[model samples]
Target: MAENTRKGTNTTILINGQRGAAYIKVHKRRHIGYLGASRMMASSTSPVDDSTPSPSADASLGLTKPTTHLRIKHAPFKLMHPTYLEDDHTTAQGTQWHSRASRKHLYTVKLAKVHLDKPSTDAEKATTSEFKIRGELRLRTCHPHSLLKPRLAWDISFWVAVWFVCGSAAWIINGFLLFIPLLYESSSQGVQAAAWGFVGGTFFEVGAFLMFIESLNSGHEELYKKALRSILNEDGGTRKQERGKLRLFGLAPFRDIGFLGSTIQLCSASIFWISTLTGLPGVIPGFPGTSSVAITDVFYWTPQVIGGTGFTIASVLFSLECQKAWWKPNPSSLGWHVGFWNLLGSVGFTLCGAFGYGSVGNSWMNYQSILSTFWGSWAFMIGSLCQLWESIWREANT
Candidate 1:
């Protein structure tokens, strides 16, 4: 019929006319680690006619059958107990009740049927059912939704990026190092490098394509557009504003920095692969002649310049992403540090290409060019390995 609760304790009184009896409910907060206090309700029948039972007497009675009429009160001295006042409260009525007072912790409110010594009537059973339903609703309100997990497509894209880097290494080692030197001696040697470059470039392209897809799937594109719209005031007010340039060269502006970098890198791979095809022996026929030499010099060195430039920009972007904390830095940002090596490789390749074209017969110039290109490839390989480590670390931490 009535309820009274102190700051730390709650008491519920139930009055029943069937047997002219009463019931009391006492709920105390307890600290039991992650497992919230049990939801089982203790029912007890009064052994003596008292407004509130004595501590020693209540302890002696333990838990008894709950009756219809009751008067519940807090034990003032129990405040000294460790679990006595830790922000917990419980209340129940026809169809509404709540427990666990503190916002700091989440506790599920559940109702367990309190078995009575005698068979319960329809009215009592209905009351019990209402308690269960209300308790379940309260639990749902406590924990609304589950946390989002990383998607499988994102993971797949990451692995593809890894493979793309590996392919680049294979292409450099097999195609350029092993095959390119023997180009004038035998056209067949060029085939090995061409095949490997194709394989490597294909993987790189696939990875880059997947990155684009993942960016869309992750909702970064829409976020970028929303940000653009806000900054540009695209909704148009009383003042007319210039239209924001959200697209570049008729394509969506790449708001995903990593994806943009990867796309550029893919373009670099394509140019370099195309260079491999053009420099093959059969492409020009008269191997060491002036015209053939001129063609070879132009075709072979030109793509390196373009590719190196793209790669340099991409490496810088990747490094910036690390600085921005977009990609979790691997223990003091190993990936960021590793990217410097790739940047160095880009410089090497760029220099190699710049000086390579006109000085084909100049032994010293040719030597410097080959040496620089070699350094670039190895540096890029090392950077790729560092990236791989970063990806592995990210997966493990997640």
Candidate 2:
């Protein structure tokens, strides 16, 4: 048996591996039980180091306190990451921590109390307070109605008047002239009648095309002014965001889709009208059924084909735009009807051109070519009138 010993608040037990039995005693109490040799340790106390700092030392440096929560009411700068600043006691400084998911929001930390060896001036404190103020600008969304103005309405009215008066009168004259060739007995009289019809058509088409150009320019100018106002007056203006540029045949740029489509259709029509001039004065002076000099070897039907194709493409694009406009909430009263009429006119023109092509191929389709052309031209003129009326209605109501 070993002699018993006592230590400070600790007791030791020894186990015999052969018997697998042990007895432990503490402060007048004893435990006798079987024990496992592997579970017993010879030295059980953990070593204490004298170099460890006490709780008082940690508290003195303000390290024991929990992190304070800060509510940033409004902030201007969008924080990207957690920003750290060295603790300075002279002036109030904040640290901003941003969440990865949200770029606009941030958590800012303002230390409650700081120690400073030197005193701060009034000017320095004022500057520090100014830095604490935060704000952000919320921009108003753009709408089509926002672009409309009184002056713009007046401009649209003036142009619409010009288009209707000239375009309508030209259509009336051409309608009467188209039937004259059938009534006339002389072939020369028919030629003269066709020449006069072209003259009237050219006069009105030019007027209508000019008005369309003016309206487009007016729209672009108004929108540009609106864009400028947005930048100078609104705080949320993003300088980098800009409108799309429109280009036609590598010339000056525009932005309005309606304007672009109309311009293309009119330019193609101008080309179509110009082609009619080639057939004029067929037997110039002395030459019989031939030109004095061979001006162009291209077939008589080539220009019509090319010009008609251009007109068809422009009409299709414009019709699509009209369909889109039709679906818009609270569109103009005449909007959908205008689109329908224009689409019908375009279809007629396409059919007319196709029939003309068939006639050139010496097909029996030539029998109906004049009738198709006459009706198609009339439909186009009617659609142009509807466009003018729609503009007038808008000007009066809007």
Residue-pair clashes per candidate? 10, 0
TM-scores for candidates 1 onward, in order: 0.47, 0.44
Per-residue lDDT tens digits for candidate 2, residues 110-218, read 1121111122433223222211211110111111232322232444334644554555455445544544454463243435544654564465456546545543432
lDDT of 2 at 50: 22
Best by TM-score: 1
Model 1 lowest lDDT segment of ten:
78-87
Model 1 backbone overlap count: 10
The runs of at least 3 residues in candidate 1 whose Cα sits more than 4 Å from the true structure, single-residue gaps closed, are 1-154, 171-203, 227-252, 287-294, 324-331, 395-398
To one decimal, what is the Cα RMSD in angstroms of model 1 from the true structure?
22.1
